[model samples]
Target chain A: MSGRPIFTRPARLAAIVPYVWMLLLFLVPFGFVLKISLSQSALSQPPYLPTFAIAMDDAAWRAALGLLSVDSFRLLLTDNLYVLSYLRSLVVALVSTALLLAIGYPIAYGMARLPLRWQPVAMMLVIVPFWTSFLIRIYAWITILQHDGLLNQVLLALRIVAEPVVWLSTDSAMYLGMIYSYLPFMILPLYATLSKMDPALLEAANDLGASPRRAFWSITLPLSLPGVAAGWLLCFIPITGEFVIPDLLAGSESSMIGQTLWLEFFTNKDWPVASAIAIVLLLVLLTPLAIYNRLQRRQLEAR
Target chain B: MRANRLSPFNIICLTLGAAFLYLPIVILVIYSFNASRLVTVWGGWSLRWYQDLFNDSAMLAAAWMSLRVGVASATLATLLGTLAAVALARGEGFRGRGAFSGMLYAPLVMPEVITGLSLLLLFVAVNAERGFWTVTAAHTTLTMCFVAVAVQSRLSALDRGLEEAAMDLGCTPTRAFIAVTLTLIWPAIAAGWMLAFTLSLDDVVIASFATGPGSATLPIRIYSEVRLGVKPQINAVCTLIIALITVLIVTASLVSKLSRARGESAAPL
Candidate 1:
């Protein structure tokens, strides 16, 4: 090793630069959200009361703190609309995650099983759509799911239905979009885990007389649990707050929490209520996120 | 052993999955050239929508804005992220390292709405105008974490001995890094920048929240137009974006492969 300390002046400066930037731009913003969540809605520019100013005196600070209340959160609990939206978001997240797993696991396993020379190409195919525009991908589905769109035309030609199915603006369309959009997120992690698995273990299982299916369950499935959890959290956490798919594809009957939050901020201009929804949503997702972080740490340590 | 072979069942799964993923996009591209006003009805293939898209000044302006923001933010994110990757990979036992790492990774999974809401609130509190710079700042913050992760992995995998050998030759630390480490990690840095740019261009939710008047990005504009109904112009725009992204990704991959092969051959004995 060179006769140099680890934390040189430039290295310390490098760490401080990103740390301060993240603290101000990333972490401190959450502080504002929390403060705004406690304040009351108003008719002013930002449409909230008790806005905290940094230059305020201690007396003013205490007064602003006094104005803070849990009423917005209380409203979320007591109101059927908000309560149903949260529950709906959770159900959608859970169900979509399961569907993604069902669809993605096999595809990932298939990609993992691809020949070495072709595996990178297969991985590229899976990642291409991921890098494309989210809105455009969703829009593509809209075109295909329209009343007189390709899906309907094919169905009509095949005599699958007498008329075009009411595909758009339904829960089914929404779920289809969810699975399509998030499939890559699920597949990537599963592929990472599955491809890393040693074939020797499977061969040993076979030598021990375990069938392929038995080997998959006893050896493969258990080994990929961390990936399963990671994929589930990746899909579930985002789907719970998904605004675009439900907004564009799902019907107006029942909305997810993300839609509710959007309406509260944009339509109603209820910043406090929107902030409360955000806080609660964050709290709800914190568990899975923490679990994911722990899993990642374990994975990194393992490596 | 049979374990290494690609089973027919697995091959079928891969084929079906690729079809499912790609068919929609393929259909979208085909319909963008449709001559008919109706999206579903394909009058003989024509460039009608693409023509219509070119004349739409609002759409063009939004695309320009998105491009500017994407470039600025991607550049900023890459710089800060490379610094961060360096700090994480090389700096040992710094103060608040845990929090530093947590803050770096949190935004990767943090909900877009929350991030947008918080950033907007931050702008409001600071009395800063929400326009080009605000959107750029928000995109930078959101994307730098991804860049950090990408670069960090590459950094960790790098052989530090090469950097050390350069130092032993009497090169200053910064010079050694520029002459040696930077050349090796260049591909990851490039990948990080591209990822940041693509994400910035594609984001709708965060842009919708953080943007003010006269600063609507392409995704925001497309989203609004799409919500009204399926316009043929939107299809043309989407096709263009998809084509651009495909080219960029392919070119980047090829370049990285070339660099990797060169690096392999140039390895010292």
Candidate 2:
């Protein structure tokens, strides 16, 4: 298999290069974060205790051995603020993902049902907005939702409300921002899967006296589950740690874990606590990631 | 089945969806030329904000840095990603392939906050001074995964027989790869590079953590000011960036369409 030793050896080496780079820069960094999570915060410049050194000092050794007081983690579990923020972030992400699905499925299905000549145009329309800067898009929402913003102006002129309803700093506004920003992420994959389906399947169901809605449910919905799952995962994971949306639209009262982590590091200057929160965040996401991997393996095997 | 028609319900959904996506951007772009300082007011059209944006030194510096960082990191990401994709797609079987694949995909799905915080800690642990390089390193790690996925899909869909045929014609393995395979995947590689560059340009959170003093990207700059309230100047800059991006995307689509018309075999990216 390797008669050409010159070519085989170098090609193998080239492959190994990226693996080593990822191991050093990607994998090893997580190890540092985990190590810092186990230590204590310091007032010194680098900010963390014994500076992630394990075998150097007795205190460092104790910290490395998990002998340090689990105070940071304890604070995380006991503090209602921290606990609620975690839960709220999860809830927001889940609800937003569901909203995206609800809003995006119809658009995707419409695109998929279009004639071949028109499908690409619909797909491009979905992607064009995504090319804009995310921060700018969120900023646009601020202008649209503020007290004297366009929405309020239009509503007042139309006699929808006597006074401008505050839409910028509310949970509903946050939900709107999330759905606006992430809808493309949800729609693209669903479009990918739905567009690939053979039209005859739906035609057969319709020919057999099933209404369009029933055919969609019985034939199309079940088939699009994989795309929905992928889009759901893509949206949920990033939205859970979403910083810009909540910071700009929802404000500080909305306690997403990402904001919480930022506060711990910058405002509180508690690097250890921030690291602890990060560790917990990673731990929380592990199950779903593993499950995703398992499903992917199964799909590959089925193929 | 062949004559599938979009019902009225589907048409409405599509129209509303398109409007929702485009309206904010349209408003933002239009307001950049507003003469009034107020964000929402329809001031008479003026180019004052665009003039101010051009003269702002801090913004000029941040834009330059962001451009340089995006280009440098995207180039690094594209090279590393291509190598990884080649291994994954071209290699028949390799040890630790599963774990390697998982490592590559983890960054794709991982939270940005966690990634930023983790990389910051790594820099501190290594006593590496956080600066331009630190941001570039973090970006390379973040974007390489995307490039790898793009290139890998292209490589997998490629005709495997071409490389074998080249090898059979007394060409060495590496020669076959360079002469046959690399040329075919060049388009995907270019697409991946542009994707990575834009991602680096648009990034804020990761740049916030991984960067040290004097490394604020354009997003960071805009975000800090946006908190005070929206300004016309910010809208001006946003329009310019969007314009640049539009040019890039239009060029990309035209290239792909032209290549397709020429009967080239590259997959749609």
Top candidate when judged by lDDT against the true structure: 1
- Give the poorly placed runs of model 1, Cα more than 4 Å off: A1-12, A54-59, B1-4
Residue A149 in model 1: lDDT: 84
- Provide the DockQ value for model 1: 0.63
Could you give candidate 2's per-residue lDDT for residues B60-160 as a string of tens digits? 88898889889999999999999888777765456887877787877887889999998998888788888789999999998998998889888777777
Give me the displacement of residue A125 in model 1, in angstroms.
0.7
Query: Which predicted model would earn the best DockQ?
Result: 1
lDDT of 2 by residue, A1-303 (tens): 223344444555667878988998889888888777767888888876655454478766655566445678988999898889889989999999999999999999888888888888999999877777788888888889999999999999999999999998889999999999999999998998899888889889988999988998998999999989988988888898888899889956658999999999978999989989988988888887776666554443332
| DockQ for the candidates, in order | 0.63, 0.57
Q: Give every prediction's interface RMSD.
A: 2.4, 3.0
Question: How does residue A66 of candidate 2 score in lDDT?
Answer: 64
- How far off is residue B10 in model 2, in Å? 1.4
